[model samples]
Target: MTSEETEEVVETTTDSSTGAARITAAPYMPGKTFTNMFEKYATDGLPDVFDISFFGNISGSTIAQIRSTMRYFDLIDDQYVPTDLMKELVGTDEETRKGLLKMMVEEKYPDALGLSQNATSGQLAKVFNERGLTGATVDKAISFYLHMLDYLSIPYSSHFKKRRPSSNGGARRRAAKKAAEPTPPPVHTPVKPKVSTEEEQKAAYVQTLLDLAKKDGADADLQDRIFDRIEKALGIGGGPAAPTTTGGGTTDSP
Candidate 1:
């Protein structure tokens, strides 16, 4: 067939199982069109133990093959694999690898086959009918589930190894809150100077008066006289006597 005829035939056979509305041919490539390979190989029933065991082994092999294929496709850069599940599988003993994959498939991807631990085949079959969990998308679903398990393991094992994150954001927030709050000012005791006793005060007063008298200035003498007058008026002696008057209007001169 001519290239045009081949293109037309390819276009006619294209299928749309995913969300896209139409299937299109690969640009500039004849007989090389997109296909839902996942849907093509996907199954709704839980796989039996034999198939489970086989696929577990198959996945590891496929992972290696995919890596090799990706290299061929020039897709390898930096690191081809993020998580080491594939690498672990490659290094692990076949029996252990099989058991691990089986456990994962049984626990997580049970609906893909009719052999899950929790749900019966009939129940899963009904779910597949209602939700249309076709075989084509099973690989993606499985990959997604395994990726989630790996994510969970990363944090879990890090904690188990005591590699906790250094910065606790919650603790930081609490500290910041404490810092933001207003603090009460410190209470301080007032210092009191030593006070003189009454006797000490009287001695000081007498000294001040004597000092004023000895000072040669007129202002100093005036201050001394004022203080002396105050002392006499307070009945300390030398003030004129106050005269007494009788209520009968007669005064006796003494």
Candidate 2:
């Protein structure tokens, strides 16, 4: 062990019951996985080696977990040969199965179980940690243990019974959903409003005057003034010059 790992080990406290655990690591796989393996194998009879040939289509890692779980419960010997306990634990008689299951818990996890008939998940985890389990292994181990407890009708406080998770579910769901969605449309930039220039305003004013002058009610005098205004506005050499005299003599034009 590295000095750091030794230090971590030194930090852990061991209960007498914890020290009694036969296996080094907890079965981090689902308890049901291996329990089912045991029951089905009991139906088919024991294998010569609990290897790929026996387990069939599952991954190597999963086979290792099954082997580890079997070791934890003392269900198999060093050669991975099924012990009599393995067969009896999966037998048809409920009473025999329950007895063996209880005995297995007392042997493997008396530390946490002895703490309380109803210890919370946190309490159980602390016991596992003290037994040198760490990282993601800790939670997974706790899950398997909890499943065993439930299977034997053992009640615990402070944990809602958790369903076994679908493998890598959240990430798989997010990836699938992302692939299925269509790409978003490109953002639309709004067109800026066109501002009228001062020259444009002036031209518009001149045009309005011209249009009014063309109206029927406009007398020639009014039309002339309007045209003068238009000429001045357009800078057509017309300025605010003196008013011209009209046929009306002294013109009323100011």
Candidate 3:
């Protein structure tokens, strides 16, 4: 071969080898900051040429692969892929940065898509209990889902209903009825009758004895004799002057 032809062929071969060894970096994820770069790329818009081959020659298969990767990682899904730009915009950490990429790759190629990658309603309580997680964890997962939905700007009606508590229907009905019933009123005590004092009765008895002694006579001698007789009969006079009476015989003051 001629020297010129040999040189040209050698250069050509070198260029081809260099091209084969070339490795491109991945592009920023799509749908960041409400910018639809994936759509634009798929529709033949060249935003920038660097690492463009990683997102190469967009097609249905490529889109599906991207979506699958995002979903598997629990970061993005078919409806959304948060861009690295968005992460930068939010100023998150390196862990999150690496995590986002890793998630995207996993979603692209999931081994078990049927299992609970993201928490679902029916699977939430079961998975939570299995993992020894709390209801708060499940609530956080739901909140995450809602945040993603909002980020996607997906419209949902406020009137949307959720599943009722899972328990016996009859038991639930009975509980509802019991809760609705009115409570009974409290009972009150009745008043009692009034009673007389013992001191009053004693005073009346003493007064009756005094009145009887006064009616004995107006004369002092008669009064004294009547008082003495009454006192003797009642065994109230003291010492030797007191009278004694027994069933066997009559007795006088000693």
Number of the predicted model whose TM-score against the real structure is largest = 2
Preferred candidate (lDDT higher): 2 or 3: 2
**Candidate 1 per-residue C-alpha lDDT over 50-117 given as tens digits, one digit per residue, 9 for 90 to 100:** 12233354454344433332232222322443234443443456456556555643443333344344
- What TM-scores do the predictions have? 0.20, 0.54, 0.20
Q: Which is the better candidate, 1 or 3, if ranked by lDDT?
A: 3
User: Which candidate comes out best when scored by lDDT?
Assistant: 2
Residue 47, model 1: lDDT of 22
Superposed Cα deviation of residue 101, candidate 1 (Å): 0.6
lDDT of each: 0.38, 0.66, 0.40
The lDDT-based order of candidates, best leading, equals 2, 3, 1
Model 1 / residue 67 / CA error / Å: 10
Kindly report which residue stretches of model 3 are placed more than 4 angstroms away from their true locations once superposed.
1-120, 149-254
By TM-score, the better pick of 1 and 3 is: 1
Residue-level error in angstroms, candidate 2, position 132: 1.7
lDDT against true structure, model 2:
0.66
